[model samples]
Every structure is written in structure tokens, then in C-alpha cells.
Target chain A: MFKAIITVKLRPSILDPEGKAIEHALQSLDYTALSCVRIGKRIELQVDLDDRAAAEAAVDEACRKLLANTVMEDYTFELQKA
Target chain B: MSKVKFGVVVFPGSNCDHDAYHAVKHVLGSQAEFLWHKEGDIGGADVIILPGGFSYGDYLRCGAISRFSPIMKEVVSHAQRGGHVIGICNGFQILSESGLLPGALLRNQSLNFVCRHVHLRVENATTAFTNQYASGQVIEIPVAHGEGNFYTDLDTLAEIEDNGLVAFRYAERDGTITDEANPNGSLNNIAGIINREGNVLGMMPHPERVVEQLLGSDDGIGVFASLINAISGDVTIPGVAVLP
Candidate 1:
């Protein structure tokens, strides 16, 4: 078994409204050192496939087709043996 | 000429399907039918509308999941054949995700769900969906959405402008495009746009809700009228070579 962990976030050029709000809250809490904060989503899935090569391709396809909007967002995934 | 047929697509979570259907069947006095999202055909409809609402519960993204549904394949094929397709609000997001239109709708700049009426300028009145209004005419339309901010790359922005594909721009009552008048901070204050072929239109405003005078503003009827005119071929349509 393998566990696929994926993270999706808006591109740096695109505005991140939620991230900006978080940045403001952090600053109010006296965490002025942080800047350019970005908000993203994390998805984890456990697959029964035993082959690593086939798992990579399937994870990538899932991210591109539904998990993320490539126009303004970027995604990355990592596979770990379960 | 045979009556121009209209189809309103009904995705799983689409709540505005009836509004679009009513606009065509009642207000415009045309035949309209609901096309299920699971089906792969749009029948003989000349114009297909992807109505608003949280399709697929906005699960992955506003339109990410709905684009993969079986019906979208048919919608794409229909557009490829030069059939008219319009996406409003959530529908607009779906069109963008489905690659029927360029640009993606991002979260509102203010991080709020804005619901109100705003003035819009008919930027290009030559397409099948905007021909009823004169170019630069200011019209009132209502917008309701949290993620209506339209974003595109610099290259795509220049391409759309060069192609005259911008269909509607938020503007003042006198038809002056201004930043303050923009409802969602959409790039270039764009409220709506069309594909290069002009058969596909995606806008963040709800035109169907304003199709009747009793609904407060009838400026939206012009959009439906334009579709009817283009499909009937009673006039020389400048775009969409689907006329046979």
C-alpha cells in the first residue's frame, strides 16, 4: 500500500485573499516577521497499488484533472510506502 | 424560421437551472429543456446555458469537479461545432475550468460574498450574445458570487483584447469603465468575456434573473434576444459561423 499526499496552492502572481487575511491576523498577534503568506489545501489518499511507477502517474493525473486548477494554482504530490 | 431552441444544463447542485429555463420559455416565448449533467447530448438546442449555483457542492474548486462530468464532454463537443454556449456565475467558472473560456475566477478581492446590482458596458456588441445592445451601452445586471474575480496571464489578456473578445465590462451608469465600479475586482474590470470564436460566453452576472421587467431590470433580455437573432439568421451575424 502507498499513501499519496498532495498540496495545492495559488500561484505567487495570483492574489490570495485568505492568505492575506491570515497575514494580517498574524501581524496583529505581533508576528510581523512573516510576509507573503499563502493558503493552500492538502489531500491524502491511500492506494492499494504496490508499484511506485504506476502510482506516480495516477497521482499526477488526479491533481491535474480535478484536485487543482492549473490556470491559477500549482500542485505537488509525494508518495510514501504504507 | 423554426423557433430557436434553448437548453439549460442541470448539474447535480445547480439551483439556478429553473431561472434560466423560465427566462427562455416564459419571458422569451421559446422552447427550453433541461439537459442532465450525466447525459452526453444537448439534443438540437441552438443555445446551451450552464446555469449558476454550487455545482458538485463546489467540492474541489468552484468548477473543478463539474468539468469532468459526462455532460461536459458533450458541451465541449457542442462548442467545437460552433454551437452557442453561455455560462453565468458558477457556470462561468465551469467554462473556464472546462477550457471553453480563458481565465479563472479567483476569490473576491474583499474576501466577501457580494450580491448586488452593478452597471455594465457592452464592450463588444458583435457576438451572438451581445448583439442586442449597442456597443458601449451601459446596462444594469445583478451579480451574486464570492469568487468572481477574473484573472488571466499578461499574454492572454493582450490576446483577448486584440481579438475583441471582451463581452461585458463593469462600468458606470453613463458607460464609463472605472475601477470603483468594478464589482469583483476582475482583471481589467471584466465582468464577462467570449472565446475567440465567439460561440462561447462566460459572465459572472445573472442575466436570467433580470429577463423580465417585473424583476427590476430588463437589460438582460437583450442577451437572449441576441441569441435568438443569431440562431434564426434573420440578421447578418458577425461571429459564430454555425449558421447553415
Candidate 2:
């Protein structure tokens, strides 16, 4: 089996409002000096396919089609044998 | 298209499809049909409406999965062919994701599901949906959503503003457009916008909810009337009085 890990994040140009609120809370607790903060999500997918190439292609298709909204976010994935 | 045929799209999780259907059928005095998302046909609908709901359980993003519904291809073509389309709340997000309309709707700034009647200023009255209201008229519409914050890049925002594509903006009851009045923190307090062709409209407000005066206000009737007017190019509603 092949396992793919995908990381999705809002584009840097876009404001992460939720992340910003967290950053402010962190500052209140004395975790300053961090100039910026962003938030994202990760998804892991396992398929029965043994070929790394095909597994990666399928994951990419998933990201482009439904896993990630390219309008305001970007996605990257890594695949490995399961 | 001699008659105004309204099509209300229904995704698996769509809860407002019936509200939209009732508003079109009874309030606007027109024939309304439900278009299933899995179906590829629009049943020759002249006006298509994407009603609001937690489609696909709001997976990945609001309206993200629903935009890929087989019905969307027909929607895009219909819009391209000068057909009128309205997306309310979740439907608004789908239109943005489908590229039928510009910009995107994000999580509400307050991180809460805002449900209330908000004053909206008609930014442009020339479109088929806003002709019933005078330019800059303030109309009360209910917005109920957790992810209604509208966002867009600066250039695209400027272009829409320059072209008067903004159909509505959050405003005060007295018609003042201010940042304080923005319920969702949408860019420029945008509540509704039309596509460049002026045929497609995507708004976060729910005009379908307040069609009757018994429900509190009859202000929303104008929106439906504007749409019926667009379809028939006349104000003669079959069984309903043409509200003045």
C-alpha cells in the first residue's frame, strides 16, 4: 500500500484570521518576537496501489479536485510505502 | 423562454431548496422546479438558483465539494449563455468556487454563525435582480451563515468596484455604508455581487426567508420580483400582486 500525506494552507497573501487571533493570544502569554503566524491542515490518505508514481498522481488529482481549494489555498503532498 | 421558469438546485445537504422553491413558486408567482445536483440537466430552466445549506457537510471548504456537482457544468454554460443565476449563502460560495462569480466567502470574522436581518444598500440597480429597488436603496435581508466573510485580491476588488459589479453592501438602516455595519467583515462590506456579464449574482443574504410580510418584512419580495422581471421583462406576476 502507498500512504500519502497532504498539507494544505491558505496562501501567504491571504490573511489567516483565525491564526491571527491565536497569535495574539500567544503574545499575551509572552510568546512575542514571532512576526507572523499561519494555520493549515494535513490529511493522510492510504491506497491499495503499490506504485509510488500512480499513488502520487491520484493524490495530486485529489488535491486539485477536492482536497484543496486553489482559490485561497495551496497544497503539497509526499508519498511513501505503507 | 417566453415564460419565467425558475430552477432551484438541491444538493444532498441542501436545506433551503424548498424555501427557494416556495419563494419562486408562490411569492414570485412563477413555475419552480427542483434540479438535483447529481443530474446533469437543468430541465431547460431559464433562471437557476443555488440554494443555501451545508452541502457535502462543508468538507474542505464551504461550497467546495458542491461546486463539482454534475449540475455545475450546465450552470456555467447557462450563465455563459445569458441565463440568470442566484446563489444564496452557501450557494454564493459555490458560485465563487465555480468561477461563475468572483471572490470567495470565508469564515465569519466573529467566528460565529451570524443570523439576523441586516441592512443592505443596493450598489447597482441596473442588474436584473436589483431593478426593483432604486439605486442606493437600503433593503433589509436576513443573513444566516458561519462562513460569510467575503475576500478577494486588491486588483480584483478594484476592478469590481470600478465596474460597479457590487450589487449590495452591508449598510445602516439610514443607508450609511460603514465598516461598523459590516456583519461578516466582508471586504468593503460586500453583501452581494454580480458577475461581469450582469446575469449571475452571489450573495450571502437569504432573501428566500422573508418573502411574506407575516414573516416580519416583505422587503425580500422585490428581489424575487426583480428576477421574475428579468425572465419575462415585465412585472405581471400570474397570481401575485406586482408590489409597488
Query: For each candidate, what is the lDDT?
Result: 0.89, 0.87
Runs of candidate 2 with Cα error greater than 4 angstroms are A30-35, A47-58, B237-244
Please give the lDDT score at residue B102 for candidate 2. 85
Clashing pairs in 1: none
The per-model DockQ list reads: 0.82, 0.56
Give per-residue lDDT, candidate 1, residue A48: 82
Off by over 4 Å in 1: B234-244
Per-residue accuracy of model 1 over B87-181 as CA lDDT, tens digit each = 99999999999999999999899989999999999999999998888888888889999999999999999999999999999999998888889
- Docking quality band of candidate 1, CAPRI definitions: high
- Give the C-alpha lDDT of model 1: 0.89
Residue-wise C-alpha lDDT for candidate 2, range B16-55, written one tens digit per residue: 8999998878766788899999999999898999999999
Give the range of the ten consecutive residues with the poorest summed lDDT in model 1 chain A.
Answer: A61-70
The DockQ score of candidate 2 comes to: 0.56
User: What TM-score does each prediction get for chain A alone?
Assistant: 0.93, 0.90
